[model samples]
Target: MASGMFDTPIVGVVNNLFGGLIDAPVVGRLVRRGLIKIRYVGRRSGKTIQTPVGYRRSGDGVVIHVMSPDSKTWWRNFLGEGGPITLLNFDGADRTGHAIASRDEKGRVKVAVQLG
Candidate 1:
């Protein structure tokens, strides 16, 4: 199997653990200090994907930095500057929002989700 195959499972396991902890009471608060969970449907496969991402609230929206823009395709779902997204906040509230993805000159991807 390719080397990338190994990372898939590890990432999934980590995400699951973080997702669970972020939904808990006390631990969730601590975890939310640096990460937030984002749930979005695949653009083509139509699968629901949930991942923990680093984010910060900006004005009326949240900003998430996508580490590598080219290798990751999930961010593509928000490329059109509009798409449904469920943001699992640190406070244990699921916030509905519209997400927009953009890439800077440095190749860093930034997703802005406008909360409803």
Candidate 2:
């Protein structure tokens, strides 16, 4: 694996071999508390589009960082057709957040802001 490429297998290895429990809640807490960042992938293209996303304590007030990247098909659908964002907690419970970014500003610095 390439450097800094800590993929799922590596995570699984750490979790299995060292008994490290790396789940959504722990990761989400890191993201929530601003320890680590949360990245969002484009649903259609499966590309990493958002990084350093900010999440609120209640899992609301989600801010996405696109880093000046072009919008993808999934983002288009999310903007046009209106889609649901499924956020899973550590307990495997999925929470729904609403996409509330305006069409005119979707391509700007602020992409989509999901609020619970």
Best by TM-score: 1
- The 0-to-1 C-alpha lDDT of every candidate, in the order given, reads 0.81, 0.42
lDDT of 1 by residue, 48-103 (tens): 98888889889998899877566567788899755899987644588989999988
Clashing pairs in 2: none
Segments of candidate 2 deviating more than 4 angstroms: 1-28, 32-60, 71-73, 90-93, 102-116
Q: How close is every model to the real structure, measured as TM-score? A: 0.84, 0.40
For candidate 2, lDDT tens digit of each residue in 20-53?
Answer: 2233445545433532233345657677543233
Q: What TM-score does structure 2 among the candidates reach? A: 0.40
- Count of clashes, each model: 0, 0
